[model samples]
Target: MRKLETRTIVVASHNAGKITEIADLIAPFGFAAKSAAELAFDEPDETGTTFEENAAIKALASAKASGLPALSDDSGLMIDALNGAPGVYTANWAERDDGTRDFAMAMEKVQKALQEQGAEKPQERTARFVSVLCLAWPDGHTEFFRGEVEGTIAWPPRGTAGFGYDPIFQPEGHKRTFGEMTAHEKHGWKPGETQALSHRARAFKQFVETCLEG
Candidate 1:
């Protein structure tokens, strides 16, 4: 079926960084994008089992709530050695609250696990960041796209540009890590650049392409 035109877009997330990224992505296309926070939308329970499910749930909820086309993204770090663990629980792998261990704690667990396995060296620890984005429309329509960044884990974390696992993730073919690179440097997408290589960027690019085609 032919997709209808979407004039206004809603991103169902309150994360400033995410909102900024999405806005930057949509700006080039001349689309007006708004965040859930701006609309004062309540955070929906992410009861889905996987990234895709969670993304769809959020997108649908937002679309229904705002009555406008909505988009959502669910992403996490999947470690090969951990059996893809932290895949869906990337946000809450460690602490719960006062003892809450955020991404930093998650990294600590990774390090400890590696030490236990006697493979703490950079060469021994490999990981990838994966992101899945879902788009939902008011008329019960939806679509999905995924992106990933493969890289080795770095100890002690480096830089501070990107958030979450960025400091610890050193992308493939690059000597510096994501957190190490400036935002401008990281967003320098050359022509023919594939968004599938970047976890969030890939998904957003795919969504944009799909929208244009639709």
Candidate 2:
């Protein structure tokens, strides 16, 4: 892996939630993280079909634009019952006609789809959140890390702490949904510590171990 030599990097995303989460994750390593939105960088279209491909696209775009290293993440929810219908299109599923996103609608749609497919039992509602992080340098060199958290879909969408489809996602061994958990609880992974609870946390841990470790 090509180690990230610089301490300052752009987080290639316009989403506020993603920026905050990523910034918090990298802050412990003494990295000066900046979001693409904060830097006035345009969000490149994610034309790739896979998480790795999309992550590379964003990372490379921001790195090239800023002439610095950039980190990008592509994540999604994949349901066993839906046969991963929304894998790469996870965000698209929540996109609104007004150019906004409605995750509550997305959750309801997922629940409805599950019911249509006869996925009633807890076992039948198995799912996972997948994330792939890419680190790219200005010269276009890049590395990728992937993570996933297994879980089951909860009906009636509980909690409101998290954004997106967190209200409907219950990670394995947990009684409460991700939406009910605080940021510290959801992203509780650390280097050489306990296992990660969220997909993004798992992927971020890998990035820290590979690039930020002294």
- Candidate 1 local lDDT, residue 33: 82
- List the pairs of residues colliding in candidate 1: 195-202
Q: What are the Cα lDDT values of the candidates?
A: 0.77, 0.91
Runs off by more than 4 Å, candidate 1? 1-4, 98-101, 188-197
- Highest TM-score scorer: 2
lDDT of 2 by residue, 107-214 (tens): 889999999999999999999999999999999899999999999999988999878899999999999999999988999776567678899999998888888776
Root-mean-square deviation per candidate: 2.4, 1.1
lDDT of 2: 0.91
Tens digit per residue, CA lDDT, model 1, 1-214: 3343866889888767777766766676667888999999998888887899989888888899999989888988887777787788887775557854577787788778767777776667788888888889877688888888788888888997877777888888888888898765555442356533457776776666676654
Query: Which window of 10 residues has the lowest lDDT sum in candidate 1?
Result: 188-197
Clashing pairs in 2: none
| TM-score against native, each model | 0.88, 0.97
Candidate that would win on lDDT: 2
